[model samples]
Target: MPLYKTLDPNSQTHVKIWKITETYEDLLQPLSLKPESLERVSGMKSELHQRGFLSVRHLLRAFGYTDLDLYYDEMGKPHLKDGMHISITHSFTFAAVAISDVEVGIDIEKQRDKIAVIAHKFIDYEFDYLNKYADDYIRNLTVIWCVKESLYKLFATPGMLFREHFFVIPFTLEDEETISWIDYKGQKCRFNASFLEFEGFTCAFTLPS
Candidate 1:
């Protein structure tokens, strides 16, 4: 198995990343999926997406769980039958998961120049510190996007707008970590955000501070 990276941010949390190098058939060989999961994978039109789905199952197996032990909530957030909090993410050639005793969220995104084009869509207050001409602009933007996305998954609240509600504290690419908040509907919660880049992709994950 191509388990690319494993991290224990805390004693109670586990993060696993998989470099997706296996064919869909090879990825499917070692696992059994729930009927719903099987159906969901079957309906995915892209073979890459199917492989990402299967790779997630492999991650679950690394955590000593199986597809049968997982389910999605009304908000489409993933949960474990044993009650541990879980979050999932996959992009291009990678897939990852974060599970913790406390609520957590994870996101992996391919670093792309296109993120700069749509930066306004998810960024508002953050614009104050972002320099579009900086050498690390794309990396910084990817981290911000991933931070907001992970916060969204953690909140799992409907109608949350990334630009309006999610805010990531400013940090340089060298910092590799920052703080973020969700300010929505008179409620505010803080989280610790951390990120790393590998093979042209950026991965960020958050846990309640």
Candidate 2:
């Protein structure tokens, strides 16, 4: 099992990352998936996606749970059968999960120049602090994107615009963590977000304040 890293951010929260070096068949051998899960995996067109899905199940096993202990809502947000708050994310060669007693969300994204092209779609208030010509432009953009995505997952509300409703407070790359807010439908909430970079990918996670 390529369990890349396990983090206990707090006493009540568990974060696990898996580096997917195993083939589809190798990842499939040790687990039994629910009928729906099997069907879902079978329908995935990408082998990398399939491996990411199965690797998550293995991550669950590391947490003393299994495919049987997870389910998704109508919004497609995953939930734990036992009621612990959970969020999952998977990118090209990486998969991650975050579970906490409090509400949480997680995301992993490969750092790429392409995100710079689409940054405007998801960034608003953050632009004031962003310098496109800066050396860390791509890295900063990736963090902002992941931060908004994590907030979106935690909010799970329909029609929430990332540019209009989500805002990430400014912070230098050295900060590693910062505060963000969700303002939508006349309600406001704050969250604490942190990020890390490894092997050219950025992983960001949020916990409600």
Candidate 3:
């Protein structure tokens, strides 16, 4: 498949998503990768992850970038050699990239009942509004997790924990938007977060609010 979706959340931020529907070999055939990137993908134990990794490279091409143009820092945060802020995420069958003049982060997750089992680990303040008995409990949990995951990626701080430092304001699925906070070490920051669900998967991203 080609680029699955493109979004301009703000004038300065651009996002591209790819639906992974090709064989690992099919994905690798077109793109030229940096040696380190080839090494990274070659070390993957699962072909699915290998395909996901390659699909993100295709996404960089959609953004007019090549693998040589992307690199990561000691914190494992991704950067574009041109100085554009960049973030990458891939889960299951979807891979996405978000680039901006300002820092930004994006995440995609497959919705599943098991997310509810680990909800406590990443959820604390959100528990105040969550109702386990609700029919959409799992869906809401997935959205919150996606939002927080994006925040964690954007912040890129060493010791931030989702359960302890991140907070999401109350929101409904229909709105698909929320204000999230990072209260780490007394340095509070906020972001405008948005999310959408498709084919039983949820995708979310955040930019400075």
lDDT of each: 0.95, 0.93, 0.93
Where in model 3 is the C-alpha error above 4 Å?
A: none
Colliding residue pairs in candidate 2:
none
Candidate with better TM-score, 1 vs 3? 1
Candidate 2: tens digits of C-alpha lDDT, residues 1-209: 78999888789988999999999999999999999999999999999999999999999999999999999999999999899999999999999999999999999999999998999899989999999999999999999999999988987889999999999999888898999999998989999999888999999999987
Better of 1 and 2 by lDDT: 1
For candidate 3, the 10 contiguous residues with the lowest summed lDDT are 1-10
Rank order (by TM-score, best first): 1, 2, 3
lDDT for residue 27 in candidate 2, whole number 0-100: 96
Cα lDDT tens digits, model 1, 1-209, are: 99999999999999999999999999998999988999999999999999999999999999999999999989899999999999999998899999999999999999999999999999999999999999899999999999999999998998999999999998988888999999999999999999999999999999998
Query: By summed lDDT, which 10 consecutive residues of candidate 2 come out lowest?
Result: 1-10
Instruction: Compare the candidates by lDDT and give the number of the best one.
Output: 1
Instruction: Write one digit per residue (lDDT tens) for candidate 3, span 1-209.
Output: 57888989888899998999999999999999989999999999999999999999999988899999999889999999999999899999999999999989899999999999999999999999999999999999999999999999998889999999989999999999999999988799999999989889999999998
**How many clashes does the backbone of model 3 have?**
0
What does candidate 1 score on TM? 0.99
